[model samples]
Target: MGQKRSTFLFSALCFGMAFLYIPMLLLIIYSFNYSKIVPVWGGWSLRWYKVLFESEEVWSALTLSLKIAVMNATFATLLGTLAGLALVRFGRFKGRTLFSGMITAPLVMPEVITGLSLLLLFITMAELIGWPGERGITTITIAHITFSMAYVAVIIQSRLAGMAQDLEEAAMDLGSKPIRVLVDITLPLLAPGMVAGWLLAFTLSLDDLVIASFVTGPGANTLPILIYSRIRLGLRPDINALATIIIVVVTIGVIIAGYLMLRQQKQRERDMQMAAQEVVKLDA
Candidate 1:
């Protein structure tokens, strides 16, 4: 009876999962449907996909989104890693709590509030310095980086907290300069966390729509903004095709990330085993 109950529970969970994804799965399948009406089967064809690629505006928006995502992700990771290192290394120094709160403020703040505040700030800066005349690509990128950096900082801080400081101390004891120790030991150990942070920031920036909408100006529209405008008119097969492409890309990325994480785990296990063997040899 217990086995049967467990099996039933598992089946129910699987059904729930399917139920949640069925609409999305059907939408994707129907992207290739030749009929205008979506959510109903017409006939399968690749014409929509071809049409999507043929549109210069779609390609332009996609390229712009990629560029902004890359820039925001890189900046966020670099700055956030530095912030995390300081938080971990400095510990409970002067105003540590305040500093930490400031670092994570972006994470809890509402997106609309953040966007409005940033828009006002940009306007003030542009008036004072005459740089960014209006909200544009630069503003959008900055806004993305602001929120994305918080995520990176949180991830890096968690990883740094878990890491033992003894390795870094040992390097220093072995006559390595502080910079050398950080470069060779600390940075290497923190690499996985940093990479994870970068990936997270990249995904966030790429997926941002609300924040992007607030900060974007003429000729600076991202793919999400363009797609959203189209959807407001009516559901198009092109939009379905676009959604399907995005789903496929995201799915592949998740799979790749899972594979990389498993590989990293295996590598860490092997290293731990080798270290144990060396310790045993020394003891003998």
Candidate 2:
């Protein structure tokens, strides 16, 4: 009976994995097809990739997306770090609960509503100040930052929660000013969390479609918007090629990050062992 149950579970897991990943694998594989018709695969070739490279629209869209992602990541990390510090380090203040809810409102709210609201606000601002002449890269980046900051704040909050407060408290006790302690101790300890938050923000910005669609104006088509428009017309081989490229790039980044993290872990372990040995010598 146990063997039968195990077999059933294994089959279910395999089916689940296939269901999730098979379409992506097929997309990657079909990227190399010479045929323009998606289903009719005529021998493997990189024809579409070359064409995708030459297409100015794809390049423009990708450039806009990358720019927004980078800007959003940077600003989100800074603002989120401040917000996280306020949430975790600062004692309860007036409207603390309200502030926390406002910070996290983007996380739970529907993207359409978020987009519509921001659009309305932007329109109001433009009328009031005559700034942001048209919704484009700037508007999109701001929209991304609004939501991306929430993810960053969450990551930073979790990190701060798990982190040792001893270093911070000790710094304060040793005549270090609050700002100095924050800069030297807290920020350094929070480096990993900041990096993680930045990456998360970047990914969220890059992947966002609905919010960006509402915020962006003419000439600011993001990669997702471009791909979405094309997919609406019909599946293009170039789109498949683009997806495969993104997959390859992301896979490589993950591998490199993993390797660096492993190296850091090993170095920390060695340092801890050496410090322990030094303590033993002092005791002796």
Candidate 3:
């Protein structure tokens, strides 16, 4: 009975995987199809892709989206790293808990509410200070950073909490000041966490749609906004092609990252073994 149940569970998991992937697979297959509606399997052609490239509007949107993603990720990572350091390493003060909560509030708040609130804030600021007179690329970047920073802060705070302070202490003992110790020890140790936070921020900024839609003005639509507009019009084969390209790019990146990580781990292990051998030879 247990074996039968296990087999049933395995089959169920396989079915679940298929259910999740089949739509994506069909979309990819139909991207090459010459038919308007998908899954009809007309003769394959690269016409849709050609049309996608020929459209200057799509390229403009894509370029703008990439620019936003890069800028937002850089700003968000810097802000989040500082916030995470203060939250995890700085002295606890009055409203420490409140500050932490406020920093992370964007994460839990619905996108609509967040966007609306940011829009209102921007309007008020513009009215008072005559800055950011209208919603556009700047507003979208601000909105994305608001949420992306929260995510980065959370990841970095966790990493900081797990990190040992011994290295910094040792550096201090060797005549380094606090800032110097941080630069030499803490930042080096936090390199992986920083990379992770930056990547997370970049992904969130790139994928944002709902908030971007609300905050974006007439002429500053990102790729996601453009894709959504197209989706509302109709499910085009070009979208499927775009999605497939994204999937392939992401897959390749992950594979390369994994390979590099494994290589680094092996290198570290080899160094440790060589050090141990040296110590053993000295003892003999």
Candidate 4:
């Protein structure tokens, strides 16, 4: 019975992995096809990659997306960190429940609804203030920031909840001002969470389609938007090539980040062991 169960579990894991990765593998393989028609397999060639690199539209969209993602991630992380600090450290301010609900409302909201609401808000703001006269990268970045910050705030809240307050309290007791304690102790401990939050926010902004579509205007296509429009026309080899490039870049980034994290963890473990040995020697 145990052998059968183990075999079943192993099979299930393999199936799940294949289900997720098979499509991507096919896409990467097809990207090299010499044929323009996606379904027809011509001899393997780098033709699409050359076409993709030379396309000014693709490069422009990619550059715009990167700029917006960077801006959105930075703003989201800053705002989210502030909101998380307030929620976790402020100790029951008035309207805390309402504030918390508002911050997290985007997480539960439908993308269509969020997009429509933001569109309306931007239109209204334009009518009243005459600012952002046209919806483009700025509007899209703002929309992305609005939703992305909620995810960052949740991450920060969870990180704060798990962290012990002893160090912060000790800093306070040692004549550190509240600002100093926060800057020196709390923020340092929250660094990992902040980095994770920023990355998450960046990914969210980059991957956004619906919100960006609603908020964007003429000549402001993001990479996803451009890909989506092209796919609607027909599947092109260049789209596959672009996707393969993205997948490769993302995979490389993940591998590098994992390696760095492992190294840091090992160093931390060594430091802990050395501290333990020194304490033992002193006691002896």
**lDDT of each structure?**
0.91, 0.95, 0.89, 0.96
Query: Which is the winner by lDDT between candidate 1 and candidate 2?
Result: 2
| Candidate 1 lDDT tens digits, 1-284 | 99999999999999999999998988888899988777667788988999999999999999999999999999999999989999998767898888899999999999999988888888888999996886778999999999999999999999999999999899999999989998999899999899889989998988888889888888888999999998999889988999999999989989997998899999999999999999999999
For model 1, state the Cα shift of residue 197 in Å: 0.4
Worst 10 residues of 2 by lDDT: 88-97
Q: Residue-wise lDDT of candidate 2 within 221-276, one digit each (tens)? A: 99999999999998999999999999999999999999999999999999999999
* Cα TM-score per model: 0.91, 0.94, 0.93, 0.96
Please report the candidate that would top TM-score against the real structure: 4
- Residue 190, model 3: lDDT of 83
In candidate 3, list every pair of residues with a backbone clash: none
Clash count of each predicted structure: 0, 0, 0, 0
Candidate 4 per-residue C-alpha lDDT over 1-284 given as tens digits, one digit per residue, 9 for 90 to 100: 99999999999999999999999999999999999889899999999999999999999999999999999999999999999999998899999999999999999999999999999999999999998899999999999999999999999999998998888899999999999999999999999999999999999999999999999999999999999999999999999999999999999999999999999999999999999999999999
Q: Which stretches of candidate 4 lie over 4 Å from their true place?
A: 277-284
Candidate 1 structure, TM-score to reference: 0.91
Model 3: per-residue lDDT, tens digit, 28-138?
777788877765677988767887888888899989998999999999999999999989888797899999999999989999999898888888999999988878899
**What ranking of all candidate models by lDDT puts the best one first?**
4, 2, 1, 3
| Best candidate (score: lDDT) | 4
Prediction 3 TM-score vs. true? 0.93
